[model samples]
Target: MAETALHNTTTSWSSDFKEITKMRLAISVVFSSVAGYFLGATVLDFVDVLLLAIGGYLMVGASNAYNQVIEKDLDALMDRTKNRPLPAKRMSVQMALFIATAFAISGVAVLYYINPKTAMFGALSILLYVLVYTPLKTKTPLAVFVGAFPGAIPFMLGWVAATNEFGIEPGTLFMIQFFWQFPHFWAIGWWLFDDYKKGGFAMLPTGKRDTKTAIQVILYTFWTVLISLVPAFGMTGRLYLTPIAAVIIGLLGVFMMYYAIMLYKKRTPKSAKQLMFASVSYITLLQIIYVLDKFIR
Candidate 1:
């Protein structure tokens, strides 16, 4: 009986750990970092790649765990987050803090083995996400804008990890993801406006989903598409996309824009949901295309 109880306890703890860290979200962010790694790596050190993945996941997980700890009370007020580890009382606050601290320190130390710049950015990502973005969520709509900086770091972080350099190449990657986030997050905010309001979190540009907000989404989506094609024009040194890849990226942008326009026309939650999915698909497909193009050409 004691053995069975131990097994159950272990299983529960594992599940709670995954929940607190947001494993899927952490992995998706790690994927973006790996994509950047593939682009900037000249020699393809498999060991470094492995380290990058581990460090990326740890840092992202730490940030998420910290967010949960800070937002436990607020999270309980929203349906989507009410059942998370902290809000659901699956884990104690002290335990969550321990996990977050362990992950953050380990992640930064591992990244430092890769390079100082990589580790610096990793630390910065945690600090900004937890200290800046989490607190600002209830204060102003500008939270999303402030959040975009740390959110955009993974793309360039992989490049820095692989190259130990920061320049136009990584800058281009940063810009592309930075602009992409506005449309993506705004769509989510549009659909979940009511849920977010329950927590007093103002995530939308206008604090309400209206024509004005939709118009802003459209503008940012357009800019995201435009910046994505800049490498094809030789504007970004050391990061040249073939004209064919450029055309492909342009088409993807157009698809994202179409949904944004649809949201603007309808101004409904359903349309916002569609735009949100499209924005996700757009970024995933864009990263695949960029990485594949780098290898194929």
Candidate 2:
């Protein structure tokens, strides 16, 4: 009977690993890593691509796992996150800890096989997101700024992976993503203001979602558009943006700004939701344009 119980426990633990890590979300993060890889990879080979995706997924998967482990208690308080495996007790703390460490260590090892620099960056991203940003979320609004470092690195990590060095091309990808996070996150903050408050997360600039916060969102949105165009102006290193691609990317940003302005003016939940969706569409579309522009040019 003891052996039977032990076997059942091991099977249950395996199931919990799948749920606790939130593989779908981690895969989305991995996809962004791939997009970054594409933007920077001058020479594409199947082997390199496979290594990048696997390492990227493992790296991000580890970060997400660590996030849940640390925030398990807080997760129970947030409606949007309360159902996560950790908070729901679907996984024991020790089990989750082991999973997080395994993924993180293995991820770095995989990246190391790509190149030492890329591996370093991958490890740094995991450290920053988990060690720095995760804890800071409950402490201050500046967490967004700190978090952007890791968030932006994926775009450039690909560049470094391909080029084996950091240069203007990867820098441009990093800049656009860095600026983009502000508005993207603020919009979510606006929409989820109540939930964040309930969870004791200080996501918004002012903690209160109102005119002050809205104006900051607008400011960041403007910055995002402006920085995105720097590549087109042909001043940001070798990453030159053709006039046509610049105009198209600009127009997309304008569409996003229009929604942002609307949300600012109305400050309604629905409008915030619209802005959030627009932000998502904006970044994804922008990434598509960046990759597509390479072919067009």
lDDT of 1 by residue, 74-97 (tens): 999999999888888988999999
Every candidate's lDDT: 0.94, 0.85
For model 2, what is the alpha-carbon lDDT of residue 294?
A: 76
- Per-prediction TM-score to the true structure, in the order listed: 0.97, 0.92
Q: Using lDDT as the measure, which candidate wins?
A: 1
The collision pairs in model 2 are: 231-241
Which clashing pairs does model 1 show? Answer: none
Residue 214, candidate 2: Cα error in Å is 0.4
Query: Which tens-of-lDDT digit does each residue in 177-283 have in candidate 2?
Result: 89889888888888888898888889888887789988988999999999888888778665667888889889999999998899889998788889988988888
